[model samples]
Target: MIVRNCNRCGAAITFVRTKKGKAMPCDAQAMPYRVAPGGPVNIMKPDGELVRGYWLESGTGDGVGYRPHWASCRTP
Candidate 1:
């Protein structure tokens, strides 16, 4: 992951390249998440895999993952 700051909100982030070779800016911190396909949220795994789910900030989860920076960008 290549670390950088969000251009809109200036939050720390890292780029995760998708299988299609698209680079996505994701939050630097990793959070636990549960698998919920067709859910309302999307998370990027450390290996660049994208999954649909919700953040598990304080409980058990399917795995740990990162959220796209745009989700929390303040200036967007």
Candidate 2:
């Protein structure tokens, strides 16, 4: 599993490799990542290399605004 922070929301998104070798978001509450047929979505990394994976955008459909970022969790 690979964990990456959302660019818009900074949420820690967990990605799992499928049996077919495709990366998929594992969080149930996360917005569905659109998978383009025939190829993976291209995301530009900080180092200028291109990466293929599911990307999530920030902001709600309603007028209300949501801050993008994963909520920090505490383990008991």
Candidate 3:
């Protein structure tokens, strides 16, 4: 599992497995970001304790993403 989040906007994230069977996060949802060495990241756990490791940039042109650049944990 990947611990990803957005620094600009505080948000948790969930990913869906691609049809190709790849566990890739949704760019339109949690935009994967470029990690900086030893830099801090956002949290995504229920208590917001899980440290996020990445953020995917999405909805650049449209200005509105399907799920936005930030999100919470997976749903039921």
Maximum-TM-score candidate: 1
Q: List the residue pairs that clash in candidate 3.
A: 3-53, 12-71, 31-55, 31-56, 31-57, 32-55, 32-56, 33-55
TM-score to native of every candidate shown: 0.86, 0.29, 0.24
Poorly placed runs, candidate 1 (over 4 Å): none
Residue 35, candidate 3: Cα error in Å is: 32
lDDT per residue (tens digit) for residues 1-76 in model 3: 3545644443444454544554434333433343333535542322222343444454332122123223443443
Estimate every model's Cα lDDT from 0 to 1.
Answer: 0.86, 0.39, 0.38
**Cα miss at 76, model 3 (Å)?**
30
TM-score (C-alpha) between model 3 and the true structure: 0.24
Better of 1 and 2 by TM-score: 1
Q: Higher lDDT: candidate 1 or 2?
A: 1
Task: For candidate 2, write residues 1-76 as lDDT tens digits.
Answer: 3566655555566654444565554332434233333434443232223344555575432222111222322222
Any residue pairs clashing in model 2, and if so which? Answer: 9-68, 9-69, 11-70
Model 2: residue 5 alpha-carbon error in angstroms: 0.7
